[model samples]
Target: MYYVTKDLFFPPVSQANRDGILAIGGDLSTERLLLAYKSGIFPWFDPGDPILWWSPNPRMVLFLDELIVSKSMRSILNRNVFTVTFNQNFRDVISNCQNVKRNGQTGTWITNDMIEAYCNLNESGIAKSVEVWQNDELVGGLYGIDLGTIFCGESMFSLVSNASKVAFITLVEQLKKENYKLLDCQVYNPHLESLGCREIKRIEFLRILKSE
Candidate 1:
C-alpha cells in the first residue's frame, strides 16, 4: 500500500501506508530528510542497502514532563559523578553508537553513508547530540534530530554502565527546560519503557509533527 513519489529524493511512500516503512531507496538530501522528519518518518538501512524509511504502527515516545527517574537513578543524578553537554562532540557520539558493543548486534546499521548523512544534517542544525563525560573522558551519550519543539532521538551508547541513562536523563531535563513537547523514540522496547516511554497511535504521533 506504499505509494511511490516521482521525486528521486522522495521515494514512493504514503503516510497512511508506512507499514512502518514509508519508502525505500532515496538519498538523504537535506530537504527530503527535513520533510521526512516533519512527517514522522526516518531512514534506517545498512550499507549496500537501499534507504528504508519507517513509521511503526505504535510509535514509542516520551513526554519530557513524564520522565520517570527511579529513586536509584535520582541518587546517581544527585551525585553528579558525570557531567553532560550538548553538541560538544557529535561525531564522537555517533561513532560510539556505531562502534560500541550492543547486546546482540554484530555489525551496525549506522553505516558510513548514514554517518555522513546525519553529519550533514547536524551541520544544517536539524540534528544534535548529548554527550556524557566523566573527569573529561567521554563515557556515554546519544544523538538525534531536533525539529523545533520535537527531538527525534536516533541512537545512544554507553562506555560505562548507567552512563547512557545519565545522558538520556540529561537530554530530557534540557528539553523540558526548553519547553519541547515530545521525544520521539520511534520503536517500543522494554529498555525505553523503564525510562518512561509509551506507545501512541501513528495518527496521534503526526499531530505533534512540526510543519517547519
Candidate 2:
C-alpha cells in the first residue's frame, strides 16, 4: 500500500494490492480527484476512515452495446412513467444517494467532504448527475465523473422501486447516443451485472481509459 502526499500524485496502478487498494490518506481536492479518475483510480472509504484509493483488478464496466434492458424495464421505459434529466439537481441527487439505505451496508461512504469535493467537480463540468423524477419529486438519481468518453459512476439512490434503474437506463442510452466508450462501475456487484455490467481485467480497463 502507498501513502499519498499533498504533491498531487499516485503510484503506478500496478502496485495495487490484491484487493485493489493502491494508496490511503489523501485529501479529496478537486485536482487530486480529477487526477485519480483520469488515472482510473477512485476513492472508497468508510465515513470515519481515511481516504482509500483503489483500482481493482477485474474492473466492473458496462460497454454501451452490452447494456441489458429487461422486459420489465423495457415496459417501464415505454410507459414514460419517469422523467429523466442530466446534471439537474446534482446536489439533491448525491445527497439522496448518501442518505438512502442499502442492504448489507451499515453506513455511507459519501461523507460531507466527499460530497463537497464532488459538487465542486460537478460545478466545473467534470462530474455529472442523472436524476429521475415522478412529477416534481426527485425519486431516484445517480452521480459520476465524466472522463470524456468514459463515465466513472460513483453512486446511485432510489426512493421508489425501479427509479434508479430508470435513471441508469436513460443515462446509458444517452451515453450511447454520444458514442461513449464505456461506463466504469469500479467493482463487481450482482445488481450491476443484472444490468449488463461485467468484469474485465484491470489492465484492459486502463487501456480503454488511456486510449484516445
- For residue 203, give model 1's deviation from the true position in Å: 0.3
Model 2: how far residue 133 lies from native, Å: 0.3
RMSD of each: 2.2, 0.6
Model 1 segments more than 4 A misplaced:
1-19, 210-212
Worst 10 residues of 1 by lDDT: 9-18
Q: What is the lDDT of residue 123 in candidate 1?
A: 91
Query: How big is the positional error of residue 37 in model 2, measured in Å on the Cα after superposition?
Result: 0.4
Best by TM-score: 2
Q: Number of clashing residue pairs in every model?
A: 4, 0
Whose lDDT is greatest here?
A: 2
Clashes of 2: 0
Clash pairs for candidate 2: none
lDDT of 1 by residue, 74-178 (tens): 999999989999998999999899999888777888988788888999998888999999989999999999987899999999999899999999999989999
In model 1, how many backbone clashes occur?
4
